[model samples]
Target: MKTINRFFVVLAIALLLSNTSTIAQEQTRPEFVTITTMHWNMDNKDFKMEDWKAVEKEFLDKITMKNEYIAASSFYLHRMTPDNTEVVYVQSYPSWEAIGEAAKRNAELAKTAWPDENARKAFFKKRDAYYSPMHSDEIYATMPNAKTMTAKPTKDMICYVRKGHFAYGEGADEEFDATSKEYFDNVTNKNEFVKAYYPMAHAWGSDRTEFLEAFFFDSMADLESMFDRDTELFEAHWKDEASRKSMGEKGAKYFDNRHGDYIYTYVAGLAK
Candidate 1:
C-alpha cells in the first residue's frame, strides 16, 4: 500500500523532468489511482447483492464521500471475467500525499459517523463479512488525453477494458505524448458511443508493462456500437490511407502486440 501510494511522487518527478508544462496546464485529472482486487465470500449462504450494496453505501456515505483527500472512489463488479466472485474498488487521489491523508481522514469520519464504539465495531463486522480475506492491489498513473464524462451517470454502466503491455523502447517521450494526445483529441473524444474513457499505465504494480484503457458505455449494445464508431472516427479523422497507417504505426511502437479485454459493471450508487 505504501509503495502504491508513493507512485504519484515518483510519477510527478519523472513528468516534471520530461514534461513540466503539461502539469501546469491540466490540474483537474487524478494524479494517481489505486485498484484493489477482492473477492466476495461465497461461503456465506446468507449473502445478498442488495445487502452488500447497502453496507457499502453506508460506508461510502460515512467515510469516502466525506474524505477531502480522496478525489474519487468507485466500485466495479466483474461482468465478463472467468470468475464471478471478483469485485474491484478503485480510489483516486489529487496528490501522493493525499493517499496517507485520506487514511487518517477516514478514521476520523468513521468515529464521527458511528459515535458509539460498539456500533462502529458491528458496522465494520457486517461490512467485512461480505468479502473474502484474499485481495491484491495495484496503483496506476493516469495518462494524458482521457475522454472525460460530461455528466455524472445515474445508473450502472458497462466498462470495457483493454489492457496492453508497454514495449519501452519507443522513441523520444515528446513523440509518444504528442501522438497520444493528438489521437485522443481527434478520434477518441469524438466517439458518441463511448460515454467515458480512461487510459492508465502501470506505476507501482507487479507488471510495469501494464497499460489499461477503460471505456464506459450505457449498455452492451452501445459497447458494440463503439467499435463500429471507432473505425468511422479513425477514418474520418485521418482521411488518407497513408496518414492512417502513419498514425497507427507510431502508436503501435509504444505497446507490444498483445492486449487483454475484460468487462465490468460500474455501480453508480457506490461511486463517490
Candidate 2:
C-alpha cells in the first residue's frame, strides 16, 4: 500500500511539472505585430512620388535591413478606400520588448546611413513631406495558429483585413475562441484560395477589445474567388439554414457590431 501511494504521488508531481512547463511556453510565445496607418500629404506641391520612393527605398534598405529586432516588415497601399492616399506599414517582432529595441536601432541606423547632420535632416524632411501628421497605431499579439500556405514571393499580394471588437462576458472569450478555432481548422484551413492567413488580438493598443484577421491572396482575382468559396464552406459546415442562423447568432453575440474591412496591395520591395 505504501509503494502504491508513493507511485501515485510521483505521478501527481510529474503532471504538475508538465502543466507548469506548458504555461511557461505559452507565456513566451514569440510573435507580436505593430500596424500603423498614415495618409499621404497629396496636396503638398513639392511632394513627388519618384523622390519619395527613393527616400523610402533608402529607409528600407539601410534602416530596416540592419534592425535585428525586426523579423519582417511590409508596406501596403490601400485599395478602394474612402481615403485614396492612405498607407499601412506593418512590422513583426519576436517579442513585445523587441518593438522598442527595433525603434532604437532604426534611429541609430538612420544616423549611420546619413552621417552628415545636414544631409540627414534633408533626407528626413523629404520623407516627412510624403505623409500627413495624422496617423493611428495599434499593437497586436499574433496568434499561434497563423499559417503561411505559399512561398514568399517578390511581388505584390492582396491583403484583406477584418477588424472587430468583442463584448466581454464570463466565459465568453473561451467560448468564442473554441468556436473560432473550429471554424479556422475545419473551414478556413481547408480553403485553398487564401495564400496565407493570420489572426491577431489587441496586445498593447488603444482598443483593448479589438480582434483582427487578415487574409492574403496572390492577386485580386484570387481574392474574389476566396469570397465565393467562403460562402460555400459556411453552408457546408452548417448544413441546415436554421443551424447556420443559430451559429451566426451565437458568434454575433461575442462581438460588437462595429467592424472595418480594408483591402491593400502589399509592396514587395518595401517588405523585409
Candidate 3:
C-alpha cells in the first residue's frame, strides 16, 4: 500500500508538468489573421481629402493605437493613374477568433470616447464611405520554411501590390485560373522574396473583374530584384521570346485595362 501511494504521487506530478508545458507551448506559438476592408472612394461631391486625412490623424489613429488585439494596420492609396480609387486600409489580428472580440472592445471604447450614440454612428458612417461595398478576408498559415524579413527599426513594412486581370471570353475564368496555376508553379514557386500573395475579386461597387492578386514584400529594393529574377524565370520556362510575349499578350487581353499596383507602409500597431 505504501509503495503504491508513492508511485501514484510521482505520476500525478509528472502529468501536471506535462500539461503545463503543453499549455505554455500553445500560448507561445505565433498565429495571426489579417482582416482586410475594401471600400470605394466617397462619391459625395463635397468630399475633401484634407478632411479625410484629419479623421485618420485624429480618430482612426487613436483607436488603433489603443487596440491591443491589432497587430498592425496600413492605409494604401492606389498609385495607378486611371484607377484613382483609394484602397483604404488593411489590419491584422493575433487570431481569427479574436476578430469579433476586438470589434466589440473597440465599440465599447468608442462609446466611452464619444458618449453620444448618434455622434459615434456618424463618425463610422463617414469612415465606411471610404471603402468599397464588399470586402472579404481569408486566413493564411505563414509558411514555416520561407525566409522572413526583419521588421525595420522605423516600424515600416513595405507592401507590393500585384494585380492580375482575368482573360475575357466564354472560358475566361478557366483560362485565368490555368494561367495563375502556371504562374505559381513556374514563377512564384522559385521566387524567395515573395512574402505573401492574396487573390481578390470585384464583388460590388467596382466593375466585374475576374481576379486581383496582392503580393507583399519588406522593401522597394526587393521589388526591383523581383523584375530581374522573374525575367530570368520567364526566359528559362518559356524557352523563346515569342512564347513569352504571346503569354503576356494573352493575359493582358483578359482585362478592360492594365492591372494596378500600390505601395504602402504597414502601420506599427497593426503589423505582426
lDDT by residue (tens digit), candidate 2, 175-271: 5555555666656676688888877778787888787778898888897787667667766776787875665555655555566778888887777
Per-residue lDDT of candidate 1, residues 38-88 (tens digit): 999988899999999999999998899999999998899999987789999
Give lDDT tens digits, candidate 3, residues 9-32. 111111111133432454432244
* Rank by lDDT (best first): 1, 2, 3
Off by over 4 Å in 2: 1-30, 46-50, 170-174, 240-246
Question: Can you give the TM-score per candidate against the true fold?
Answer: 0.90, 0.81, 0.50
Provide the global lDDT of candidate 1 against the true structure: 0.77
lDDT of each: 0.77, 0.71, 0.51
Q: Rank the candidates by TM-score, best first.
A: 1, 2, 3
Q: Candidate 2 — what's its lDDT?
A: 0.71
Ranked by TM-score, the better of candidates 1 and 3 is 1
Report the poorest 10 consecutive residues by lDDT, candidate 2: 8-17
TM for candidate 3 is 0.50
